[model samples]
Target chain A: MKKIKVFTNGLIKENPVLVLVLGTCPTLAMSVSVINAIAMGLAATAVLICSNAVISLLRKVIPDTVRIPCYIVVIAGFVTLVQMLMEAYLPDLYDMLGVYLALIVVNCIILGRAEMFANKHNVFESALDGLGMGFGFTLALLLMATVREVLGNASFAGMSIGFLQDYKIPILTAPPGGFLVFGCMIALVAYLTRGKAPIKKSFDCEGCPSAAFCRKEGKACGTAETEAK
Target chain B: METYKLLLKIIMTSVLVNNYVLNKFLGICPFLGVSKKIDQASGMGAAVIFVMLLATAATWPIQTYLLEPNGMGYLQTIVFILVIAALVQFVEIVLKKFLPSLHGSLGVYLPLITTNCAVLGVTINNITDGYNFLQSMVSSLGCGLGFLLAMVIFAGVRERMEEADPPKAFKGIPITLVAASIVSMAFYGFGGFVTSLFGE
Candidate 1:
């Protein structure tokens, strides 16, 4: 039951892209297409699940001072493994994802999960959390990409919506378009989730025990993890 | 001559014609988050240029020699990201220990570069675009400067917008988005200029 809450939290409440706002770099770069978004999301999810499971299992053994670097090395190892498999099998998707794939090592989603959940939680719970967040991130990105690609490129998925029926807003597909879409989504989420979220001040609690607790301390606090290295 | 043309194309495309920030939206986090003031923007820009240039230089060798030759191409994402993070850490330490002034100004933005899509984007672009080491270096340099130029200009504009009267909804980020759109359109004008100079 508690694991279920953890899972659902990632889908909506602690969403990596929309709610938590973690991992914006890939959220913006690879979100050019729904397919890319889904592919990238799944790839990250696979890496996240494996990394989380491994980290959770090895959490006690890892030294304290070297925790962050250790997490990075573990995450990087999995990411490299994924990169090799993708190149061999999903070469097209690999090409499309470009550097954003390699950029996943620093993706706050994987590392954030490693630190916040996996390092502390049991393997089963960590895997569930990773799966949930991965899917949630994929969903958020798909939502964004749907709007961006359909409006920006006048297509849903790879197929064109049709010539007369489909109208591409060129701006929505461009750089400025990305900003606009991101802002609108953020505003929409804030509006939808308003009043439910408690607002608080101060966010330097780097040593805080509970992320969800600290996150609830402020509205923008958890979102700033999007910017966390 | 062919190599020279490719280099020139890369420089122009990355710097003006298809800028990573203004045109590609690769590094909007820093572009929006860190670009509050021109001076700081310039500093961030310089730091990004240095990092991007260095990252591309380093990744090229790793990709070509270590990954491709050894059949470890699958490790590109993992290796590249680890390299980038380590590189950022190395740069942070060097700046702190050697160039204190730069370290101070570039303090906050240094770690952020680890996740900067633009840095990773250029490194990946270098390989995808088939740029040899020299060409990738030049391209990264051009992209970095282009990013700096966009950030500084936008920062200046945003700084001025603080004093301007605007509606409440479109005041903060909405207005900024509109501003970015206009700026993007303005950048499109440079495309024509590049075409005229280089001849498509």
Candidate 2:
């Protein structure tokens, strides 16, 4: 049950995209289309799981002072692996993902998991957390892509929706639309959870890798109070 | 004179049209997370500008001279990131030892920059965009200036947003994101302006 809970933690409760809001760049950039979004999610997921498992296994071996860099080196290696395989076999998707696939090395989700969860947990649990978080990322992308591609483009996975074609909101496919849709999605989630979401701990600066040298009393990532008040 | 015009066009386009944060969706984390205070935002922006310029200068030579000749183009991602990570560390140490007052302000943001996607994005983008070394530097400068512009502008916006009270749910990041949506729409208007200014 505990292991299952670890696996299910990211599904909704700690959904990385919506709830925790870790990797917003990839979540926003890649979710314009269903296929690209899924491809991005899975690629990042593969990197996430492998990195998490490896980091957990090597947690004892890595020094405390340089752990973040070590985690990054590990994550980058896996990302490169994914990049090569995708380029060779899935060239089209490879082109579509572009710099984003490479940018996954800087993704907060992978680094955040390594810092917050994987380092302290066992290898099996860390991998499970990675899987759970990866799916959560994917599911959020699918949700946004459906809203965007269907409403914005009047298509589902590149297939035109005959009736909805005339009623599309084309702006949803543009860059601003990504921000608008994501803002609305996050608001919807916040409302549904009645602002009681389990986001307080992870909502702060911990998830960001730069927090390693943050001199701002753990508030380097700008808390809500600081931003609005 | 023609070369100067071309460089000016690249700067304008990157700063206004293809903005790193607003358009390209790179570096949204710092754009969103650190823009609350004008001072901090500018500090972060300055650090980003410095690192981005340095990263581009470092990576371009490595890509053109080292990787291209060796048939190791596939190693770009790994090599670039490691170089950036090391470069950031070196900058931090040097700044602290040689320039304490400057470090006092910018140093806080340096560590956070290592994983900031925008740094890597600019470096990789400079290469992929196929700008020669000098062009890459100009584009990166424009990218950094654009980022700084966005941060300073958004800091003012967030200050206004703080005065308005939204519902309970849209109070924090959600509302901030929605505000970003509106700001980005405004940025979209710059598209036509940049094209006309530079004659496309």
Candidate 3:
């Protein structure tokens, strides 16, 4: 029961997507199709879970000041490992993902989890956190992909719907469609969750992994807020 | 003259056609995060352009002579990211020591660039596109300028959003994202047009 809470936390209450919004790049790019979305999500999840566990195991040994670099190295190692494995076996998905597969090294979700969860928790728990967040990320991607694919491409998982084929909005599958679907999905989640989830301020409130650094660097957000008002 | 046109085409393509932000979605975090103010957005954009060029210059040769020659290509991901991270740090330290005034404006953005997918994306993309050293550097410049172009344009759009009111649910990031969608759609106009400008 205790384990369940840790794993489920990332699903909705604190979804890495609709809520935290850590990895908007991959979330926006690879969600053009259901298959690509699942491929990207699971791939990032694999890297996330491995990096979380490894970082958890070495949490105590790594010095606090240099931990960011340490986490980056570990995460990059896992991303490469996953990249090569995928390239060798899943060449099609590899080609589909392009630079994004390699770009996962800098993904805020993997590194953010390492910093926020893994370093403080036990290995098992950290792994579970990774899993939960991974699921949340995948689920969000799946939702966005469904909207984009069905409406934009008039297909579901590469299958054509005869009736909808003639009425497809091709723009929904393009770059603008990616952003529009993501925006609406997030708005839907916001509407559904209402007062339950933490209120999100525009631009990198809690979701941004670099929020801490940006704040430390003389409060870029602070000044921006002042100007916005 | 022919080489110049080719390079010119590459620059125009990256800037307008294959924009890193609107089309490719490389640096959406900073795009949405820091673009509230034009000054801040341009500062970040300028810093990104600097780092993107440096990262490509550093990574292209590493991939060509170091990784490809030794048949250690698998190490590209790890080595490139580390080199970028270390380079950003080295740059920040040197700027702080040697050019404090410049660092004051740009230093805040250097650390952010390390994690920015745009920097990493442009570097890896140059290699994947089979660009030689000069071509790689040019594309990097083009990509960085494209990023800056997107940031500046979005910053202006966002400033307008500050005055406009929207629904309850679409208030924050949602509305901004929707606005971004519109802006992205507008960028589509540049497609196919670049090719026509410089005959095949």
Candidate 4:
């Protein structure tokens, strides 16, 4: 039951992209098409699950001082594996993902999970956490992609929606559209969660994954409150 | 002259046309996080620029001489990230040791850049774009400068945004995102400048 919570927490309560706001780069960049969104999400999930389990297995062996580097190596190895498999089997999707696929090495959600959850949990629990977080990330991507693809390209997953084609919002397919859609989705999530969307109080080092290692970890660093005054 | 022109074009394209932050969405975390103040933004930007140049310089040779010849191209992601992580660490230690004053301002951001997609993005982009070592160096510098430009300008805007009373829902990141969208829209004007200039 508790393990279930660990898994389900990533679904909504702590959705990586929506709630945690970890992997926004790829979340915004690759959600232009539904198929790309799904492919990116699944690829990330494969890496997440594999890395989480591996990290969990080696959690004890990996020293605390070098854990971040270790986790990154592990995650990047899995990402390369995923990249190779994709290149060989799904060249089209592979091409579509492009640099973003490689950029998954730095996806905060994957690293955040490795640091926050996977390193501390058992293998089974870590795997479940990865699945849940991966699914949540995928769900958020799917939602954004659906809106973006339908409005931007007037298509769902490459299939043209006849009526919408005439009224497509070209901006929705661009960078600005990515930001707008992502912002609105964040707002929607916040509203649905009753303004409890883990809205970061500030953009300081506090929220940074490396905040623990920061020289000024405890004190206020980059808060708007401090800067505004 | 021809090679120099090509290098200049690559720099311009990376800086304006395909900005790592606004256009490519590479380093949104730091773009949004460190943009609260011009000083912090610039500090982060300098650190990013420093790290980006070093990472690309290191990775380009690794990819060309090490990975490509050995047919270990698939190891690009893992190897590049490790290189970046180590590079950032090296930078941090060097700064702390030799330039403690500079480190005092930028040290906090150095560790953060290890996981920053922009650094990794620039390196991978260099490989994918088929840029030679010198071209990759120039492009990485330009990308870093572009990120600095966005960060400094966005920081100025955000400084003003503090006074404006936004709505309840759009108070924090939502409004910032909206503002970023507008900024991104403004950057679109530069999208065609490269193509028109280079005839590509």
lDDT of 2 by residue, B1-200 (tens): 98999899889988999999998999998898888778778888998999999999999999999999999998898899889989998998998899987777777678778888998999899899899999999999999999999999999999899899988777788788888888888898887787777675
Please name the candidate that would achieve the greatest TM-score relative to the true structure.
3
Model 1, range A82-155, lDDT digits (tens) per residue?
Answer: 87889899999988887777777767678778877898899999999999999999998899899999888888
* Tens-digit per-residue lDDT, A180-209, candidate 3: 888887788788877578746565535355
Q: Per-residue lDDT of A1-229 in model 4, one digit per residue for the tens?
A: 9998988999989888877777889999999999999999999999999999999999999988878778888888888889889999999999999999998888888888888888888999999999999999999999999999999999999999999878999999999999999888887777777776676544555335565455334544443224322
TM-score of each: 0.83, 0.95, 0.96, 0.95
Model 3: runs farther than 4 Å from truth? Answer: A205-207, A211-229
The lowest-lDDT stretch of 10 consecutive residues in candidate 3 chain B is B104-113
Say which prediction, candidate 3 or candidate 4, comes out ahead on DockQ: 3
Q: What is the lDDT of residue B161 in candidate 2?
A: 92
lDDT of 3 by residue, B100-152 (tens): 87887888778777888998999999998999999999999999999998999
lDDT for residue B141 in candidate 3, whole number 0-100 = 95
CAPRI-style quality class for the chain A–B interface of candidate 2: medium
**Which sections of candidate 4 miss by over 4 Å?**
A204-207, A215-229
Over all chains combined, what TM-score does candidate 2 have? 0.95
The stretch of ten residues in a row with the least summed lDDT in candidate 2 chain A is A220-229
Span of ten consecutive residues with least summed lDDT in model 1 chain B: B166-175
CAPRI tier of model 4: medium
Which model, 1 or 2, shows the larger TM-score? Answer: 2
Question: Which candidate wins on DockQ?
Answer: 3
B16-124 per-residue lDDT for model 1 (tens digits): 8788877776776577666666876787798799899889889999999888988876666667767887888788889879988767666446666775678877888
Give lDDT per model, in order. Answer: 0.75, 0.88, 0.88, 0.86
Order of all candidates by DockQ, from best down to worst? 3, 4, 2, 1
